[model samples]
Target: MRIALLTEGVHPYAQRAGGGWCRRLVEGLAEHEFQLHLLAGDGGGSGGGGGAGEGPATYGPATYELAMWGRRPAGRGPAAHRRRAYVRAYRELVRALVLPGERGSFASGLYRLAELTRQDGALPAFLASGHAQRVLEREWRAPGADTAAGQPLVRDVLVAGDLLEQCLRPLSAPWYGPGPGRLGAVDLCHVVGGGPAALPALVAKRLHGVPFVVTEHGLHLREQYRSYRSAPYRWPVRALLLSFFRLLTEETYREAAVLTPGSAYDQQWQQRCGADPARTRVVHEGTEAVGREAAGVEPEQPVLVWAGALEPGRDADLMLHAYARVRAELPGARLLVYGEESAPGYLDHCKAIAERLELGEGVRFAGLPESTAQAWAAGTVVVFTGLTQRSPRLLADAMLSGRAVISTEVGVAREVVGPSGLLVPPRDPAALAGACLALLRDEERRARFGLAGRLRAQERFAVAPVVTAFREIYLELVSHWPAFPAVDGADGGVPRPFARPAEYWVAGAMAEAH
Candidate 1:
């Protein structure tokens, strides 16, 4: 069985994000064969360091660049130290973003980004290496580059555009392969990341009879909203950019033969944004269930653990506000905020909130909680404060560690926690605080809830069940009906899938014998 593992910022790239899940997915279903179709991006923001442009082909010994982001020179390091490589990658990335609807959308995008690469390099190198000076040099004075002034102004506005493009480079990549001209062959395009990644999947499914699958582990548009909204851009531009992510998300969901969101929170968003519920499934993020044997946390006081990006959507500040109330009730209580400062002003916000709530004493920002079990082990209760409910893995780990949870009413928390843990409405610090205080006061009740959550996590969130479900879905989609079989066209090119247009599966299925 041929599978096109369509992904963005994962796989071949050594990152702990969506790529990890794709690797596990492939490893799980080793029984099936896979061919990757990638839309690459830099690991940290440069243009071409990405393994995405090519990947090692799986059908015997074949070589290709996998989808990734970054360009550190084709040669080895210690010479020139990646200064020029990033400049070249950024030129290409900028070129890709600037060109629009000039016959080929993807091609137009490719050239724009490529030109940037030739100028200042890719996004990852630019950000990781701290070479914004080069961006200034090229943005205003490239030989063929367009600038408002005869000389580089270094205006704040231009800097804003530069930053916006820098952030979006990952969201915008040459699909199918390194560039628009090349698209690999695959049975289906399984988009590991949505939004920009999904756009290419739609194109692939249309150009070929490629069955498209979308797996959203982290919501792309949600991240984009956070990006454009808080970006230095003013109101109008932010709204417009967010709209782009929204539209792409809708189109991606519409094109997918199956839309598997990593959590129930994502599933709702997909439907809200126009995905067909029939085509959607909530495939919780898989875990090994190793926590049962690993660590067991026994915090002295009623400890609350919140580990994730300290950002707006996660609402760490609000959690702090609630914690102030909890401390009033339980003075010896402790809180561990795990995760790096992802958004600007977010870490400050958490600190200020902690100060105002006057619970700043024992609250520590534990970066990237060594392990889910370690994070969960620190708390008698794991709490989530976001209004956005994606799969609450924080709770899953807590449950697995035998810790009760206190989460806001958003995402799969209600479904996962049910009657086991205290649930509060999101953004309401009073309610969140009150729940924490209640849970702290009742040790026996907290232990019971923890036990229930642990049972549920072990029973449902285990990886095997998830792999089996996906295997069945794949078999059903394939054997339930035959898709395009290879056929040659008049020009000797292989005509796209089976024998008809790819739309037939969706359209023809609607009218068949019903």
Candidate 2:
């Protein structure tokens, strides 16, 4: 079967953990042909010789690489009739964003704009034009509009217009056409999360009746909300942009054939965003299982390990305070932090906090470890201090390596840890320190929890189960959907199961052998 994998920002090219996961998914399902529809944030420095539709040289071939994104060139404005059509669609779209009662027009307006984009190649340039900004300003300040309260300035209109143009640029992407290599020809469209990345799948479904599935490790709407809260925009601009995102998420969730959230927490977020519970499923993020030889045997000297990107969300401050408490009692306890600082100055901020607490030699920033198993093996107890986590891949890695874990109660942490590890309230040093001390003092309990955690990780979070689940989902979607453009000819005809041979579930195992 041919699958269109839609992604944005990170995937295949990025060296980050998110990119690693996408690479794993594509490589794991080797029997099926994958048409990658990536929307790179910056369409440059890919080390490849050319631009969009060219996969990185390592992958070999344009069919596998249909990535798009770059600075759009300024062009002539739309023709007279086309300008009127643009105004109508842009007005409806902004009305849906600024007027609460007109929210239902969002889908109609969005699709209309997409159709216009397909017809007019200059849609991005048109969106950046004064005509588009005028349409947006008129709607934003119209009677009963939510954003009118802010009395938006001309500068706000320009910035908001620019943002809308960037988000809607996917409407102009070339991936939606019908034929062998387009999204219209795919047996299934698997979108890796949602937001603008979903625009192509949305367009394909609207134009060709294709069904698309969305997988969310964390709800993109939630991420947008968090981001916009700290965004340096005026009330009108922030309100307008956030409304677009929230409404877009609703559209994506409402139209998706299935929503696979990596954690139950994200499933709840989807439901709140208007996703049907009947169509939602919880599929935990998968990871390669750590081998027995690579597993930790429990470190000496009562050392505690912290893994994951060093960012504010990881709450290194809370961990330091908790460790200070642990050090006060145990005196010999040490905390070793492993991972790169994701944001500039975050490492120094953490170190400063440590100094203020006088943690001294008791704490050490060890940078990223050679391997996850090695990191887990370096400490007696693995501590997860993240205030929020969607799937916590490192926690799974630690469990697979057979280490006792103490995690702050957050998204899926309690679910992932289950009965195998300790949980504490987020931001509470007392609870975290107590849990750490308990595990550190008792080797037998630690051993029991470690064994249970390893068993749990093996049963649920292993890569094989995730790959199998998606394989079955793709088969089920294709078998039941008769309108799939790829299956039916120009003349309506009976639908058939995917033409590909039975999936080779051993692809991962074979790759490991090599």
Please state every model's RMSD to the true fold in angstroms: 9.6, 6.8
Winner by lDDT: 2
Candidate 1 lDDT over 5-89, as tens digits, reads: 6555542212225655666678788877665544444343223533333343322211123334333333222126554654554
| Candidate 1 accuracy as TM-score | 0.67
Candidate 2 structure quality by residue, lDDT tens digits, 1-514: 7788777764322211245556677777788877766666645444221234556554332433222434554446678888889889888899999999999999999999888877766678788888988898888878888973688899999888987887787787766665546777777788886888898889988887778999978677777777776677898998898899899999999999999998887888788889999888888788766445536456569999998889899998889999999999999999999999987999999999999999999999999789877888888989998989776566778888788999998988888888999999999999999999999999999999989999987878878788888877887877666544442354245343463323432464688899
Angstrom error at residue 476, model 1: 1.3
Among all windows of ten consecutive residues in candidate 2, which has the lowest summed lDDT? 10-19
Estimated TM-score per prediction? Answer: 0.67, 0.87
Clashing pairs for model 2 are none
